[model samples]
Target chain A: MVAIAIARQTVREALRRRVFWIFLIVAVFLIGLGPVLGFLTPKESQTIMRSLGLAVILLAGLFITIVTCIYLIPVEIERRTIYTVLSKPVQRFEFVLGKFLGGFAIVFLSIAAMGAVFLALVYFQGTTRGPDAGVLVWLTSGKFPKEMVLGVVLTFFQMMLLAALTIFFSTFATPVLNFFMSFGIFIVGNLSSVTESLTTSKNGLTSAIGKIIHYMLPNFGNFNVQNAIIHPTTEISNQGVFIRNNIIYALIYSAVLLILAVIIFDRREV
Target chain B: MATVIKKYPFETVRRRMSLLPAVLAGLGLAAFMQGQIDPDAKQFHPKDNFGKTANGGLNNEFLLLPLLGFREAAAGLLWVRCDEFFHSGDYDAILPLVRLITWLDPHAENVYITGAWHLAYNFTDANERSDRRYIAPSQSLLEEGVENNFDIPDIKFELGWQRYDKIKDFKGAEEAFKLAVATKVNKNSDDFPYGAPLKTLHILAHTYEKQGRIPEALEEWKLAIARSEEMLARSPKDYSAKSLHEAEVRNYAENIQRFNNRYSTTGHDSVNPSPYPEVLEPPPGSADKTPRSWDVAFKPELRIVRPKVFKVGGQFNSQDGARIDVRITDWNYQDRKITGTLNDFSVDPAQTILIDSISVRKNHFEREMDMSKDPKMYSFSQDFYRVVLSYNPRTTAPHLLDRFGWSGEGMTDAEKSHVFMDTDPDRTGTAYIEGQGAVPPVWDGKTVPFTNHSQPLRLIKVTYKISREQIMNQKPISENDIVSVQ
Candidate 1:
C-alpha cells in the first residue's frame, strides 16, 4: 500500500511538469513525421523510422531521467519540502525508490506509445512500398544466412544502461556536471572497444591508460546491434544468444548503479 | 507616456502573439526539411573545393543531410545496377538512368567508368538482341562529365579506358590517360589514405600499354606485381587490396603477352604436343616404321581421313565422287603420288569425305579432297567395290555440338557423323548438340549465329536455341586452345 502511494505521488509530480508535455509534443511530432519521412526516403523509410524511433525513446528517456533527478530532489530541498516528508514516518530509501520508479514509469510510457506508433508506421511503409525496407528486413531474416540477433539486442541494452547511468549520476551531482559526465561516459563507452584493444598495445603508457579506461569507464559498446540489425542477412545465430546474455549483464549493471544512487541518497545531509 | 497608455493595442496584441512564434518555428522547420521535400534541391553540392570545407562539412559533408545522404547512397547503388544493364546491352534504360544518377550525384566516379565502357565497347552479348542506341547517350554523358569536372582524373581514365576497349583508339586512349596521370592527385593523407602516387603509376602503366609500349607496360605490370606481393607478404590473411593488385598485375601481363603474340610469327605457328597421335617419326636407324609412342597404345583404333582432316579453303572432291586426293612423302625415299578413284559406294555408314583420287607410290601416298559445294555433304570411298572407311556413326553427343553446332538439348549419332564431323568431345566435353538435321551446318537459329570449333574443322550457323552457360568463357578458350595450323 505504501509503495503504491509512492508510485502515485511520483506519477502526479511527473504529470505536473511542463517538460513532460514538451517531450510528449516532440514525440508526437517525430511520430507524426513518420509518413513524411516515408515519402522523403522512399528507400529505407522503415529503417529510418525505427532508428529515429529508438533515438526519440532514448532522448526522451534521458531528458526525463536527468531533469527529474536533477531538479526534483534539488527543488524539494530548495522548497524545504524534504523536511515535511522526512519528518513523517517515511524512510529516505522509500523516497528515492519512489522518485526513481516515477521517472522510470514516465519514460516507459513514452517509449511504449512512441514505439507502437513507430511500428505502425513501419507496417504502413511495408504495405505501401511492397516490402519497402521493413519487409525486406523480415524476409531476409530466417531465409538466408544471418548473424546472431542477440549481439544487436545486447548493444541496445548497453545504450539504455548508459541512460540509467546518467540518471543515477544526476541523483548525486549537479545537472551540468551530470550532463558532461554522462556525455563523456557515453563517448568513452562507445570507444571502449578501441581502448580495450589499446590495453594489449605496444606502448606501455598508452596500455596503462587503456587499462585504466577499460576498468573505470562503462563499456556501452556491448549494446550496439545497429550493424547486425541493418545487415540482417549476414547475422550469426550465436550473436543473437550473446546479445541476450549482454542484456542481462547491462540490466544488472544498471541495477547496481540504481542501488548505489539509493545508498548515496540515503546518507545525504539534506 | 500618458499618450502611449491609450487603448491602441487591441489588434496589435492579437496579431503579434499569433504570428511571431508561428513564423519563426515555421521557417526553422522549413530550413531543416528542405532537403526532405525537394528531390532536385542543392543535394550533394560539392563542399570541398579541393581544399576548404563547403557549407558545413568538408568534401560535401553538409550535403549528407540525412535526407540527401539516403538518396546519395541509393544513387551509388543505382550506379551498380545501371552498370549491369549496360553490360547486358540494355542501353535503352541504361543511358537515361545513368544520366539521372550523374545529375543526382556528379561525384560518382565509378558510374562514369562503367557506363563509358558499355557505350564504347558496343560489345553485345551472345544473344545480340539489345538496341545499339545506348552508346551515343552513354558517350555524351561521359563527355559532359569530363567537360564539367575536367580536374578529376578518374573521369578522364573512364574515357581513356572506354576508347581503348571499345573504339580501339589506343593512341587517343594513351593521350587521355597521360592527361589523367598529370592531374594533381589528393596529397592529404585523410583525403585519400593510400595516396595518389600508386594510382598515378597504374594510370601511366595503362597509358603505356595503350600506346603499344610493351617493354614499358611489362615493367609497370612487374612493378605493380612486386608491390602487391610485398603487401601480401606483410599481411597474408588480408584479402582487401592485395588480391585486387595481384589481379591487376596478372591481367596486365596477360594483355602484354596477347599483344606480343598477335604481332609475332613465332606465336602464329606455335603448337604444343597434340593430345592424339597424328605425327609419326621413326626411331634412329630402326626397322620399325611406327612413331615413338608418348603413351603405350595396344591396337589403338587409328582413324585418319584423306586430305589430313578438313580445310576451309581446300578445293575439289575425289574423281570417284567418294575419295579425296593426297600427296605423300618419305624422308628416306622420293616423294610419291598415289591416285585412286572414289566411288559413291553408299554403305550403312557413309563417310563424307569428298575425295578426287588417291595415288600410292613405294611406301608413299597422297590424296586430294574437294570442298567446292556450298555447305554440302559428300561421301568418300577407299575402294571401288566397297567403301573401306565410314564416318564414325556414333559421334559423342558433346563432341558434335561442340564442333558443328550447339542444339542445346541432345545429340544423335546421325547428327554427329553426317552433319558435324568437326565435333571433338574432348575439347568441349560439357556441351552436346541437339535437334539433328533441323539446324544447318552453320545455322542453329539464334542471334549472332556462327561458331567455329577449337580445331576450326566445322562452322556452325546458329539460328535457334540458347548458347547456355555464358559467352564470357570465350576468352579462356581462345587463350588456351585455338590450335595453330602452321
Candidate 2:
C-alpha cells in the first residue's frame, strides 16, 4: 500500500515536467505530418507513411522513457526527499520498486498516447482525396492498416524495458552519467541482432565482436518487426507466439535489472 | 581497482552474486527471443533489407539504416535515387544502383521490371545490335522477382514477355504465362491484385499461334473470354469491362474464320467442325520435307553502290521466312571461333559491318542499307574487302525451318567460279579493256576469294580486289562470279 502511494506520487511528479509534454507534442505533430511526407517519396506512399510514423513514435518514446526515468531517483536524493521517503514505514526495496513502477507509469502513458496517434494516421492514409478532401476525409478514404498495431505494441514493451534500465542506473549513478550509459547500451543492444550475421563474416575480428555483442548485451533488436510489418507476406511462423515470447523476455530482463538495483541501493548511504 | 575492491566487504558482493541465477535466466531468455524473432533461414532475404547482402560492392552507408531498424524505409529511399539515375541517362550507374535497390526492397516489383528492361535494351553495339549479353541477366532478375512475389502475377507476365519478345523461346513464354494465369488472385492486393488474368491469357494465345499451335491458341482465347466474364460478374456496372469482353469474343470468332479460310486447302473454315492441324496443319514429315529440302535455290550477288550502303540481291525457294547472312569485311578477315565461355559485353565496335539481314524469300531479295547515316559505325578503312552472301539453315526462322531442317539439307548455293584480279597487265582477257590498262583494281597478281570453300553450305562468295578509285565510282565496278542464267 505504501509502495502504491509512492508510485502514484512519482507519476504525479513526472506529469508536471514540461519536458514530458514537449516530447509528446512534438512526437504527435511529426506523426500527424506523415501523410505530407508520404508525397515526397517517389512511390510506395503507404509503406513510407507507416515506416516514418512508427519510427517517430519509437524515437520519441525512447527519449521520454530515458529522460523521465533517469531523473526520478537522482532529484529526490538531491533535494533530501529520499530522507523523508525513507523515514516512512516504506522499506528500501519497496521504495525502489515504487519508483520503478512510477517510471513505468510515465512510459506507459506517453507511449500509449504516441501509439494512438500513429495508429490513427495509418488508418486514415488515403480514405478520401481531390478538391473536397479534408483532414477527416483523408483519414477515412483508405482502409485501416491494422497490422501496424503489432509494431506499436512491440515498441512499447521495448521502451518499458529501456525505462527499467534507466531507473536501475539512477538508483546509483548520476543523471548525466545515467543518460549516456542508457543511450550507449541501447545502441549496442540494438546490434544484438547483428551478431548472427557478423559471426559468419570472413574476418576473424568481426566474428569475435559479434559474439561479444550477442552474449553480453540486452536484446533490443528483437522487438523490431518493421520489416515484416511493411511487407506482411513474409512469414513469421506464429505472430501470437512470437510477440508473447518477446513481452515475456522484456519483463524477465527488466525484473533482473530492478532486483540488482534494489540490492545495490539497499546498503547505500542517503 | 584492487584497493577499492578490498575496501568493499565480501558481504555486499555475496548479496549481488545471489541474484546471478535470475540474471543468467534473463539473458538466456533474451537470446532465445532473438533467435525466435530472427530465424536462421527465411524465404525472404534478411541481409538484403539491411544492405549486407553482397560482399564487396555493398555500400557501408546503406548498412546504417538497417542497424537502426528503418530497413524498409531506407530501401524505398534508395529506389528513388535509382529513378533519378534513369531520367539522367546514366545507364552504367543504374546497374549497381539496381543491385542495391532490389537488395534493399526485394518486394519492389516495378524496380525489378525496369531494371531488367534496361539491361535487355539499353546497352547496344555501335551498329545497333542490342547487346544480347545482358538478356540472360535480365531474365534472371525477373525470375528472382517472381520467386519473391509468389502471389503477384505482374513479374510473371514480364517474364513471359521477355521470353516471347527478346529470347523468342515460345515454349518458355507459354510456361511463364500459364503460371501468371494460375496466380492466386486477390482483388485487394497492394501490388498487382487480380482484376483479371485476361492480359496473361491473351499473350499466352499469341505465343501458341507463333509456335504453329493453332488448336492451343484457340483454347487460350476462349479462356480469356471466360476470365473477362468473371470480372464482369464481380462489377456489373463496369461497362468498360463488358465492352472489352464483347470485343474479344467478336475478334476471336472473325479472326479464326478468315484465318481458317486463308490457310485452308478448300478456302473455308469452321470453328465448330475442327480447329487447326486437321484444318490448318500443312502437310508434315516427308510431305513437308520433299519441296523445302532442295527447292530454295540460292543465287547470291552483292555490290557496293554507296559509301555506307550495299545492294544485296539474292533468289530463294520463295517459301517465306528466309533470311541470308551478308558480311562485308577485310579480305583477310576470318570468323572468330569463340570456344569457351563467351565474355558477354565484348561485342565491340566492328571496323567493318556484318548485317545478317538480306531478305531472300520473296522471288529476289534487294535492300539498300544506309550505312552512310552512321559513318562512325561503318568505317571502311580496309583496301580490299569481300562481300559474303551465306544462308545457313541452322540460324533461319521457323518458316525456313519448315523447308530446310537438317543442317541446311535442302538449301543450295549456285556454282561459284574461282574469279580473281588479273594483276599482270600482259594478259589480255575480255574483262580487260585496251584503254583501261589494268582491269583489276590495285593488287598483286594473286588475290583469292575470301574464306569461301567448295564445301556445301558456304553459300555465295564475291571476292573483289577494288581500290579507292572503284569505291569512288571513278571506274566501272569489277563484278566477278556474277553467275547469270545458263
Candidate 3:
C-alpha cells in the first residue's frame, strides 16, 4: 500500500514537471500538422497522416521516458528528499517500482493523447478529396481502428520498458550519464537483431560476443507493428499471440531491470 | 582519532540477496521471449541483409540505424531526401537514395515504380548521348520492383511500355503486357481505374500486330474488344471515349478483312480484283479478234470436268471426261506454246509433273491427264494439286492469282509457294490456267461456270471422288498416255 501511495505521488510529480508539458504540447502540435503534410501527397494522405502522427507519438514517448525517469532518483538525492522517503516505512524496492510505474503512467497518457490526435487526422484526411480517401473509407469508418489501438498499446509497453531502464541507470549513475546510458541501451536493444544475425554468420570470438550481446540487450524491435497498421498488406496473421507475447516480454524485462535497480539503491550510501 | 566502525545489517544484506533469484528469473524469461519473437520480426524490422545484395548494398548507417529502432523514421527521412534529389533533376544521386529507401522499406512499392520510371524514361531521355547507358539499369530496377511487388500490375505495365516503346522488343513487351493484364487488381481502385486492364490488352494486341503475328494479334484484339465493352457497361461515364472504342472495333474489322482476303475464296473477287483488261474470244478456226503484243490483254476461260474424288494409285479414270478446257483470244494463237507443271504439295520436287507444249488450235486448247500413264508420278496422296502455267509471255511472270494478282508487288518464288501450300488451306484445289478454256463446260449433267477474268489467268476448282480399293490395285501406265493436244 505504501508502494501504491508513492507511485501516485510519483505520477503527480511527473505531471507537474515543466518538461513533460512542454514535450506534450510540442508533440500535439506536430500531430496537428499531420493533415497539412498530408496535403503535399494528396494521394497518400491517410498514410502520411498516420505515419507522421505515430512518429510524433513515438519520439515524444521516448523523450518522456529518457528525460523524466533518468532524473527521478538523482534529483531526489540532490535535494536530500531521499532521507525523508527512506526515513518513512518505505522500502527501496517499492520506491524503485513506484518511480517506474509513475514514469510509465505519464508516457502512456501522452501517447494516448497523441494517438487520439492521429486518429482524428486520419479521419479528416479520409473524408477529404485526398488520393487515398476512397481506400481509407473502405478500410475504416467513423469508429476506431482496432489495429491502430493495438499499435498504441504496444508502443506504451515499449516506452514502459525504456522507463524501467532509465530508473535502473538512475540508481547508480549521475543524471547526465544515466540519460546517455539509457538512450544508448535503447539503441543497442533496437539493433540487437544485428548481433543476433552475426551469431549465425560469423565464427569464433566475434560470434560468441555477438551471441552474448544479443541475449543481454532488450529486443525493442519486436514492438514495432506500426508498419502493419499503416500498410494492411503487412499485417501479422497471428496478432493475438504476437501482442500477448510482446506484453509478457516487456513486463519480464522491466521487472528484471527494476529488481536490479532496487538492489543497487538498497546498497547505496545516499 | 577513533574511526566510527559502520555496522552492516545482516538482515538487509540477506534481503537484497533474496531478490537475486527474481532478477535471474526475469532475465531468463526475457531471453526466452526474444528467441520466440526475433524470428517473426515484422517488415519495419526486416532482416539486416534482406535487400543488401539486390540494392547494391545499403550503407552501414542504414543497416545499423534501424537496429536503434527508428528504421521507419530513417526510411521516411531518406524518402524526403529522394524526393529532393528527384525534383532537382539529379538522377545520378537519386538512384542510391531510392535504393536505400526501398531497402529500408521494401513495402514502399511506389518508390520502386517511380524510381524505375525515372531511370528508364526520364533519365535516359534527359540526355540523348547517354540514353543507352541508362536502359539496362532502368530495366534492372523494374525487374527488382517486380520481384518485390509481384502483385502490383502498374509496375508490370510500366515495364511492358518500356520494352515496347523504348526498347523496341515486341516479344518482351508481349510477355510483360501479358503479365500486366493477368495481374488482378481492384478496377475501382485509384491505381487501376476502369478499363486499365482493357488498355493493357489493347497494347498487347498492338505489339503482336507489329511483330506480324496476325493470329495472336487477332485473338488479343478480340479479347480487348470484349473487355472494353464490359468495362463500358459497368461504368459508362468512366469509359466515355467512344471514338477510341470505335477505332479499336474498326481495327479488328480491318484485320478480319485482311485475313479473309488472304485465305477465303468467297470475298477475293471484291477485295482483290484482277489488274488486267477483259478480252472476248473469237470463233474456233476463224480470224482471231485480239491483238498480239507483249501487253495484250488475253482473258482466259477455264473449266474442269472430273470425278469429285480420285484414287491416288489407280487410274483417275472418269467415264464422262477428266479434262481441262482452255480458250485464248489471240491472233497469233498458232504461234504460241503453252507449258506448265502440275506440282504436288510435297517437299520433294520429283513427284511433280512437267507439262510440255500443250497444243493449241485456232483459239482453243485442251489438256488431259490419265493416272494410268506414269502412275508413280501421279501416285496416291490425299492432298491438293496446284497448276503452274507458263506461255509465250513467260518472260513476264505467269499471271497466277497467287503470284501476280494477290500482291501487286512481285513475289519471290518462296512466297508464291507459301501461298499455294499454306496460305489458304481450303482453296488449294482452285488451279490457275494461263489459256482460255470453254466458256461453260458440261459436268455431271450441269454446265459448270468459270470465274473468267482478264487477269491472264483463270481459276478452276475440280473435285475427284475415288475409292480406296481402285487406288490400291492400279498398275503403272505408259508415259505416252499423258496427252497434250496441239
TM-score of each model, paired residue for residue: 0.38, 0.67, 0.62
Candidate 2 residue runs with Cα over 4 Å from true position: A1-33, A37-43, A67-70, A74-81, A127-142, A172-217, A232-237, A267-270, B1-20, B26-53, B85-93, B122-133, B182-196, B240-244, B247-267, B270-486
**DockQ of structure 1:** 0.02
Q: Write the per-residue lDDT of candidate 2 for residues A1-270, one digit (tens) a residue.
A: 877888899999999999999999999997787677554443466666777777777888989999999998899889977877777566777888899889888888988898888776665564313354665665565534455777888888989899999999998899999999998888777765456678578999998887667655667777777766665344444667777877887887788788878878775777
Candidate 2 TM-score, true structure as reference: 0.67
Q: Which candidate is the best by lDDT?
A: 2
TM-score leader: 2
Candidate 3 TM-score on chain B: 0.45
- For each candidate, give the interface RMSD after superposing the true interface residues on Cα: 21.8, 6.0, 4.3
Fraction of native Cα-Cα interface contacts (under 8 Å, chains A and B) also present in model 2? 0.28
Candidate 2 residue-wise lDDT, B190-223, digit = tens: 3234523567778897776554344456677787
Candidate 3 C-alpha lDDT tens digits along B205-267: 777654434456667878877766766787787645465577779888775554444333334
The alpha-carbon deviation from the true structure for residue B346 of candidate 1, after best TM-score superposition, in angstroms, is: 72
CAPRI verdict on model 1?
incorrect
Q: Candidate 3 overall Cα lDDT vs. reference?
A: 0.57
Q: Could you say which candidate leads in DockQ?
A: 2
TM-score of the first chain alone, every candidate:
0.77, 0.87, 0.89
Error of 3 at B156 (Å): 3.0
**In model 1, how large is the Cα lDDT of residue B392?**
18
- Kindly state the number of residue pairs that clash in model 2: 7
